[model samples]
Target: MPINCKKQTLPTIEKEQIDLLARLSNASGVSGDEAEVRKIIREEITPFADSVETDVMGNLIAQKNAKGKCALHVLIAAHMDEVGFMLVDKDSEGIYRFSLIGGIDERSLAGKQVLIGKDHLPGVIGACPVHLSTKEERECILKLESLRIDAGPGCTDLQLGSYAVFATRFQAFGPSLIGKALDNRLGVATLIELLKHCPEHIHLTAAFTVQEEIGARGAAAVAYNHKPDLAFILDSTPAMDQPSYDNAENTQYRTRLGFGPAIYAMDSNTLYDHRMVEFLKTTATENGIPYQIRQPGGGGTDAGAVHLSQDGIPTATISVPGRYAHTAVMIARKSDWENTLRLLTASLDSVSQDIFKNER
Candidate 1:
């Protein structure tokens, strides 16, 4: 029998794109301690950025001069932090106790592995075994109060107040991407690409924001400092497309993989600028790109703070869908990320001087 191998042609957005995301998603940047993630972004943008400034709040605000007359001074933002834990105390046996840094579901945290501090000390979030739990205990989900992070019995590198993050390594399989912190890492990588391909028609102000996991504080600072004509926030949103526990049709599938980027009209924060909304969807339609209207509901992005910055600014939000966000592992479709990039690039490229001329 002859040995057989098949030639494979990957997606147009291949290794280069995936590589950047891998580095970003794998880096640890929990809320306040964003230096690790910022370093990568700073180096990546140095060549393309006209000016880069690290704000007092740690927001990496970069400007890229337009190749031609600026049609719109557009502020584009992608936060650089993820939900994680901060070491609060070390237990008697060398195990540690930590408090969550951002919004994370404790119910699913037990047994998940983690990395603590700059050393990336490996650890696991341990929970009570089923054999030791009563029927009532098993009926309820695990809470933070009952958990401890075990770095092993003799570990000593970390100290109290150090940050910790999930140790999920980024992986690409077929069209699926799995990793930790894809929520905003995808956004961060996308923003870097946008800056490299900065649109000639707009004065691009890119904010690789910090502390978005802690109420979008970094975004708030950028908005006040940049004061652009309009803004677009790039981030990731949850794709609750999984099958419902009941096994019935999952009607609440807010976004499903392969559908395309989700356009935000309204979230828990600011209602996105209406004309900006029309501009985005129209661009997607004209370009024959698929897009989804994220149902008006709870949840928000950097735009929440940016829109309120400096009297007010017109804003729109877009997100690549990731399932199981704010958890140890997240899943996103490669196609969705590609489409998101396509939509954002096209929208930025064609943004006109009159885009904000229309009334609110």
Candidate 2:
């Protein structure tokens, strides 16, 4: 049977959208402290959503109801949190010891500029000077114990338990976007665009989740509450597409820049529902949108928790490939971000219960 395609014209990624992405990337929203990011999304989406509410767990769930009866309920989620640090103890007048909030790489911490708390107090991660360290000590990895956040001697407003993040500002290169927290902020911006131009035939539930970098905590609460007929998890996946040290073919490149959106099949926590996977692939193909299959491997997204809710809900994950995730900064291509938006828009426009009728 031939599938009839409406083939709606795709929307272009304009400056306004890029500006939104920049704001989202620049804002500090460490895991469990996503109020800033949540506020931005809420203001942008409130006028478009049929109803909006934040859950007890801090997931911002926005609903856009379909007009007709028997419409399939669809949920699309993008987490709002990023990995960062938490000040645990004060060491001196302006020095503090901090603990990692998520899976941030300790190797990237030395001498990095950081912004602490809501005030954005400037600080630097200080480490032992290389010139003074013994050769044997220099050979070892720098542990968290050896690091201190120095905010300067006059810093009196600093408080323990405050959150801190890299002070990297968003930048637009020739064809790339570089910024902190691009991992999920790219997804956040994508979801915001979808909300503004949602289709009219199906119920749309948009979840801007939190605490995903620590664990998919907010997603779990969202899934249990909404229980949409199906779901799509939007996130940014790490792209190990850099050249191999041996100069050999980089067969293990998880995803490549400019290739297109990466659709997941399997990961550490979830085996994506095949029907949803095929649906996305078919939608992309029919719409002439480019896409790539994310290499099946470890690392999971909110789909890890979403697919396991309430006797199980069918779910799939689509990501924009990014380089250097969970670090101080990340790089992603604008084309890939645009194409990801295109594929999701096309899918939402065409989704139907026929997806579930197909065998699992």
Clashing pairs in 2: none
Residue-level lDDT for 41 in candidate 2: 98
Q: Which stretches of candidate 2 lie over 4 Å from their true place?
A: 1-8
For candidate 2, what is the total of clashing residue pairs?
Answer: 0
- State which candidate has the highest TM-score: 2
Over 1-360, each residue of candidate 2 has an lDDT whose tens digit, in order, gives 012325556777889999999999989999999999999999999999999999999999999888788888999999999999999999989999999998977899998999999988899998887789999998898999879999999999888999999999999899999999999999999999998888888889999999999889999999999989999999999899988899999999889999999999999999999999999999999899999999999899999999999889999999999999999989999999999999998898888999889689
| Candidate 1 TM-score to native | 0.94
Q: Tell me the TM-score of each prediction against the true structure.
A: 0.94, 0.97
RMSD of each: 6.1, 2.3
